[model samples]
Each structure stands twice: as structure tokens, then as C-alpha cells.
Target: MESSTRTGFAKRRRSLQGPFLSEDNIDVQSDVYIWNSLLSGYAKSSMFNEALDVFRRLLNCPICVADSYTYPNVIKACGALGIEFHGRMIHGVVVKSGYVCDVVVASSLVGMYAKFNLFGDSRILALSLQNDVVLCKSLINVYFACKDHCSARLVSENNIDVQSDVYIWNSLLSGYAKSSMFNEALEVFRRLLNCPFCVADSYTYPNVIKACGALGREFHGRVIHSVVVKSEHVCDVVVASSLVGMYAKFNLLGDSVQVFDEMPERDVACWNAVMSCFYQSGEAEKALELFDRRF
Candidate 1:
């Protein structure tokens, strides 16, 4: 343990090293609030190895009980460290802990499986949680992650936004676009546009535009481009890069060049996109010119 962790955590580390406790004998023995706080802090701070050490100690403690809150961050650390074996073991713990469907806990489990590239396991875990019931907000991200567009949409019905949480829609859309399910991504974007309160943001458009480009939806891409010009995120470089790539994908290199040339400023990605567009269009001279010229 580091000195910084001692701020709010004094007994946590010591208590975590008690004796080998079995989950099968879960008669609940100790208050693990401080322990959880400690682990959560370590995992969130990108201290993967430290988080695992704490988790191991927590399991060895005869008095402390692991709950739904305990697994997510530790499992996230497993994913971050690419320890698929440890992650899967913790996943079994999650299942046995009866938090498989827990709204607060399920997303991390699903995301961890995705990180493991066990997409099938991710889908199985998600479907088992639903059990033919309507999908909850947390399960939507991994559904699209496994390329199950129908279930993702089924869960993403406008009614699911009872709290009017834009995060639900954003996660749903991002999952689809990120997994290369372009049509589904567009459908989510359409629904997002229809929702009066669930406004899109800078984080939203690049995935949507990437989806459009992948599907060769030139008309839809152009429509989104016009909307980008009017929206507050127009000046966003990532959105700008996506636009440049979208036009290039549409075989409208002229439009791509125009979008690139008009940028008030450019990042390496934006410059690369424009340069690649020129290079792909057989304009090696322009690409070289851009490469040699740096602001």
C-alpha cells in the first residue's frame, strides 16, 4: 500500500489479509466498505497489479464478504491488464454472487468479456440476464458489442429512457458503430435525433459518421455533415476528421479536400486523413506537400 491510500484507508489493507474465506460459507462476517473503497480507488487509478493484490487479499480474508460492488472495478482492472484468466475467474465469482443481472454490475462484466474477445460469452452472459425480459440500459452496450442489433434495439426503445438519460442512447449508438454494425448505428442515430431531450454531442457524431462511411450512405453522411455545420460540435477536430474521411469514402475527394482545407486548425489525425485521402486518390504530389508542410 502507498502513503496516498492511507488517507481514508487505514484498516482496509490489514483486514484484507485475514484467512482463507470461502464463498460457499458466506454467512457474512465483516463490513467491507473500506475494503471496497480501497480496491475501487486502486483499480480506477490504473493500478492494475495493485488492484489484483488487494482483490486477492480480500478473498483470503475470512471475515469480509464480496458483493456486487466489489467485482466491477477489479474485473475492469483484469481487462485493463489483459488478464483474461483472472477476469474469467472473477466472472465466475460474479455469477455465484448473484449479480449477473445487477444493473450496476452487469455492464462491467459484459465489457470485460468483450475485452477478452469472448464475444460469445458476452452475448451468453447478457442473454442469460434478460431471460426473455426486456433488456435494461446496462445490457444494451454489450448486445451491440456482440453484433446483436435486434436485441440492442429492443432494449433501446424510447420507453427505456424513462429517466431521459442520454447516456443510454449514446452507449447504444457507440456500441453499434464501434462494432462495425453500420446500419444499426445509423438507426440509433436516427432515434437519437428523434428524441427531443437526448441531444448528441462531440463523442456521438464520429461513430455515427464512421458508420455512414462504412455503409456507403453518402446521402445520410451528407445530411449529417450539414447538421454538423449547424451543431455546436462543428469545430471538433475528431468530427472534422470523420467528415473528411466520410467524403473520401463517398468518392468525392473534392469535397474531402474542401472539408480538410477549410479547417481552422488541424491535429495529426486530421492531417493524416486528408493526406491519406489524397494518397488514395493518386494525388501523391498534394500528399507530399501536406506532409512537408507543418504549422
Candidate 2:
């Protein structure tokens, strides 16, 4: 049986190489796996039309019942093509197949619906995930993308315990920052600091610094600066860039310059940050000189 399966796969590969690998020649019972493999191949190659064609063909195949793997790949194809109707159809299949409760499938549905701006369906699907941290984060991100800060906060507050992982805290803080709830984001940042063994990543500090910049909360930014120094994460380009940007936003051009100078490594963004500070402070000539040197 294994040898026959190998032979079938080899034949399928050869058939695939031909110009006319049509549905007529494929033995439905023996070729179901091959068809699914081809569908995945098409999806991975970004051949959305071909992937959908294979998916549609699979729907009619007697041997190919829509399963967990099949639905996720087709949903991904729908997402890639921005085909909301197709996604909804796949959602229906998910429900019919009793796969809606599958965490992986449910998460894919949430991501697909979110990408297509189907927030209602996305929220419903997201809430159904039992213990999926990534799905919860994706749902928070979707709400954040939709500019529904209240809903995002509610999702985070309800689904995420105080003992949630750093990724969850970062996601919640990022959602707050994106919504311009700088004070709330700062509060969360403080709470994160209090968590035992909780250390901020490049993502955590940048968003928090951005919140400080947006709110003109330079004192808060300074305190964060102290933390960054103590944590030895100050060398991260993103953190340094955010610090420069935060100082610049508060009209502290001198402080911005000082931070820029102290950065161990500099990127184009860091150069831009300093140049922006100079320009915003009415030192256009210095800004131009810096830009010229950097470029």
C-alpha cells in the first residue's frame, strides 16, 4: 500500500508537469491527497485562481470532504484574494464540518475575517477560541485595526488574566497606544514592570515611548529612559529611535540630540529622527547638513 501510494504521488507529480493536468485524469479516491497537496502548493505560490480552482474541484470530489487542513488553506486563498464571499462560504463549511471549534481553524477564520474587515464575524469567531493566545492577540489587533479601542480593551481585559504572557501584555499595550490611550498604555507598562521575570522587548518600549511622545508626557518618557538604561536594552535601534522621537516630540531637541549621540548603533531611522528634531527646532541648516552626511 505504501509503495502504491508512492507510485500514485509520482504519477501525480508527472501529471502536474504536463500542460493539461485536468480533473478528468485524476482518480478521486486515490488522488485526494495529491489534490490537497496541489491546492496548498498553489496557495503557497500565490496562485489564488488556481488554488480556488483546485478547492472548487475538491468540493465536488467524492473522496475529498472538507477537513481542517483543506478549509484553512482555502480560507488563506480567500484572504489573499480579498474574497469575502468565498471566506464566508468556507466559514459555512467550517460550521458544517464541526471544525469551527478547532482552535487552528477558528484562528484562521478570525484572521481571514479581520483581513476582509468583517469585524462582526471576526469577533464572533475569535471569542469562540478556547485557549489560543495567538488568536486572542490577533483579535485584539483586529479591534485595534478597526479603531475600536473600547472593544479591544474589553477583549484584552476579559480574555487576558494579569498572569498572561508577555506577548499578551505587549499586544494590549500596543492596542492602547494605537488608540491614542497613552496614559492607559503607560499604566499597563508600569503593571508589566511589576510582573516577576517580565522583561520588555524592543516592541514593548517603542510603543510605550510612542505613547509618551503622543501625549507630550516627557517625564514619563524620562522614567522609561531610566528603565531602558538599567535593563541594558537601550542599545536596541527601535528603543533608541523611540527615545529620540519622544524627546523631539516634547520639543526637547537638545535631549533628542544627546540620545542620538549616545546610541551605540544607528540606522536610517535614527538619522531621520535627529534630522527631524533639528528641523522641528528651526535648525534647518543643521538638519540639511546631517541629511547630506547620512545620505
Candidate 3:
């Protein structure tokens, strides 16, 4: 009964909000509290579209600005709705509005990515806030915790630590790889090889390997494998899994199997990768056999 009353109140408030402000001689542009309440009501009632509409109204209202109080439940709505394009746009606004550093707003953004696994959207959002190191670090940590190392590889971002050559070079490598500019990716990798300050870590090999695979340059991939082996960075699960896929992409079944077999531990992704490699290579029995071993 009480829940129904709250819903009724929310509905009536939506209808009468403008008139109530006008009648009360309140400046709609200055009364952010009213707008926030409306947003909260719509979001709490699961009226996500309505809440976003209210946000649009708030944005359209002259001289009005959203405060720290405005974003949590609304962002929750975005996550509930899969953090769509609108959410990404709003995040850009949040950064510009300088509310991104607000603990509540930060939490909501983190929750949107962390709870929903919208790493792609989250990564985009994180990259947009190039000026806020704290929020970027927070979001980046979440991506790393989720083992989404690719997202950590950074896009075409320049603001992140120019002092760290590895960070900058990796960003170039990853940005090129992500954009499917395989030649550019390899160029960056090759350049990094000569840079005394930039040593490619486990973080660096996956995208470089992916580019080699994309270009179908198995020889280049093998050369990188040699570098990884010499650098003693071949043991990481991510890099090892990438090697498995890269060798498989080259149709080097023996090489792919050798890489897979050498892993000290196998995650589900690594297991699925090798199975798919086997299945694609017309080794159905072997795929099933591997599945049984996994079980």
C-alpha cells in the first residue's frame, strides 16, 4: 500500500512539477532540487526512459546544473538499460561538468562497468576523461580486475603518463590494433623494440601478436615469440592465450597445441580457444577429448 502511494506521488509530481514551480514563483532554472527529485522518482520507479528525459530537460534548462546528488540512480538506470549510447554521452557531460570526481558519481560509473561488464563502454567513458587521473585509475583498476587487459591497453589517448614510455607506446600499439590498422600496430611494436626506455611487457605482446595474426605474418609473430621468451614474459595467461590464438590463426596447429600445452594453468577462455582451434581444424574427436580432460 505504501509502495503504491509513493508511485502515485511520483506520477502526480511528474504531471504537476512545472505548474507547481510556476505557481510557487520558483525559477525552474535555479531549482535543481526539484529536477533531482523528479529524476530520483522516475529512476526509483524503474522509469528509466523517463529519468533520461528528465535529465535532458535538466540539461536544456538554462542556468541549471546538476550537482553531486544527481547521478547515482540515473546511472543505475543506464546500467540497468545496458549503459547505452545515451549513457556514454551523459558520461562525457559528467566529465565536463566536473561531477565525475564526486564519490557518488564515480561509484555509479564504476558500478555501471563493474556490475554490467560493459567494459567497452566503460573504457570509452574512461578514455574521455583524460584529465581526471583518479577516476581513470579507478575505472582502469576495475578493467584489470576483470582481466580485461585489452581495455587497459588504452586507445588514442595522449594524456596518460608521457613520462612512462611503455604506457605511451602500448597505447599506440593498442590503439592501432583496435582500429584494425595492423601495419601501424606492427610499426609501433617494431619502434618500441628499438626504444631503450620502452620494454614491452606481458601487457604489450597480445595486441602485437593479434596484429601479426591479422596480417597473417606468422614469421613476425614467431619473432615476437622469441622476444617474449628472451624477455621471460611468456608465462602470463593473457599473453600465452594470445599466442595460442595467434598460432591457431596461422593454421599452425602443432604450434598452437604446443603453446596451449605449456600453460601452467588454463582459464575457461584458454580452454575454449584451443577447443575451437581443434574443432576448426577438423579434429572433432580431439576437441571433445580436450573437453573431457578439462572437466
* Candidate with best lDDT: 2
Write the candidate numbers in order of decreasing TM-score: 2, 1, 3
Return the TM-score for each candidate structure. Answer: 0.62, 0.69, 0.54
Superposed by TM-score, candidate 3 places the C-alpha of residue 260 at a distance from the truth, in angstroms, of 1.0
For candidate 1, the 10 contiguous residues with the lowest summed lDDT are 20-29
Task: Please provide, for model 1 over 1-295, each residue's C-alpha lDDT reduced to its tens digit, 9 standing for 90 to 100.
Answer: 5665654344444444344123443443355775677678777556678778878878887788788888888988998998999988888888888877677677787778777777777766665665323235667855665556665665545363432566666777788777777887788788788877667888889999999999998999999998888896768989999899888777788999898888887888888888888888889998898788964
Tens-digit lDDT track for model 2 on 1-295?
A: 6566555645664467343345455554345566667777666666677778877767876655666777777888898899989888888988988988765677677778777877776766665662566666666676676675655555555444423667877998988877778898998898789777466777789999999899887788899999998888899998999899899899898899899989888988889888998998999999998788876
**Tens digits of per-residue lDDT for model 3 on 1-295?**
7589667966696465567444444476578888888888778777787788778777876667888888876787887788667677777787898888775687578657755677766676666654554555454444545556566546324553431447556655666677777897897787778765547888889999999989999899999999988987788898889989888888788888998999998778788888888988999999999999998
Cα-based RMSD of candidate 1: 8.1
lDDT of 2 at 142: 61
| Clashing pairs for predicted structure model 1, backbone only | none
Clashing residue pairs, candidate 3? Answer: none
lDDT, model 2, position 179: 76
Model 2 lDDT-worst window of ten: 17-26
Best TM-score among the predictions, by candidate number: 2
